[model samples]
Target: MSGSQALKADALDFAGDTATYALSLFVIGASLRTRALASLIKGASLAAIAIAVLGMTVLRVMNGAPPEAATMGVVGFLALSANVASVLILLRWRDGDSNVRSVWLCSRNDAIGNVGVIVAGGVVALTGTAWPDLLVAALLAGLFLKSASAITLQALRELNTTGASHATPVESSS
Candidate 1:
């Protein structure tokens, strides 16, 4: 809602998260392979979100936009608190399936990103520059990339294992 570049990027991140969680919910109870597929989708979505944030940061840098530091801090705090709650709720389901794991990972990454935003807000306030906000946005993007890669790898492994087990016929006992 805020026109500040950082806040806008943060909003986009939240929107992406909402979509990711919704997808995860739909696939939570699916088969192992299906869950793995969902995880892959989530990973791709995370990567897309990161790329989008980075792109927005670059554009803001080019345009020399300075976000309102106080607003950034306030929003960051609120977002962090919300993400912490989401993470706590998803923590138990983290090891359940690929879909659930992806949900947990997304929530965890969001919390960390929110902290970065808060720090960026403080730095921006002190320096009166947009660099801190851009830096934080980039860092958050990197975090998203890291989590996406990890989730995707795990999902691929699960898919392979699940597929192989199904394909291999069990030996009959004498």
Candidate 2:
């Protein structure tokens, strides 16, 4: 396994992506308000992940250990491929509301993060320093935080504009 903090951050973000995507799926046919609420939740979770990544990145910087370059390159490439495929598929829906946009942004961010990891691996191999890896992790954390803000803002706007009550309905199962 790669000792890359950037890779760990990527994995953490991907885990958040998986959970949010599942939530998105559940609300696909829901009302606009519901979708907006879901998007807000997703945004909050993304922000949480970003904070977590920052904490780890600081620890990695203090540790100052270079990752395994070979492993980082291979894994980053594979992750990039998968995320790029997702980005292509989600391109058309990227213009939609926060619920839809969140998915697109997450995929795009994944690809970007993967690229950073790959570059960091190369830099670490060349310089034999942990700076590149730690820097990439910090940058990825910032990316996540930015995306979180965007998603949350759009979701709030959608929630305000949607013609519905703010309170979510409680489903009754007979």
Question: Residue-wise lDDT of candidate 2 within 79-157, one digit each (tens)?
Answer: 9999999999999999998999999999999999999999999998999998899999999999999999999999999
- Candidate 1 overall lDDT versus native: 0.82
If scored against the real structure, what TM-score would every candidate get?
0.89, 0.92
Angstrom error of the Cα, residue 92, model 2: value is 0.3
Residue ranges of candidate 1 with Cα displaced over 4 Å:
1-3, 168-174
Model 1 per-residue lDDT tens digits across residues 128-155:
8888888888888888899889899999
lDDT of 2 at 25: 96
Candidate 2 lDDT score at position 3: 82
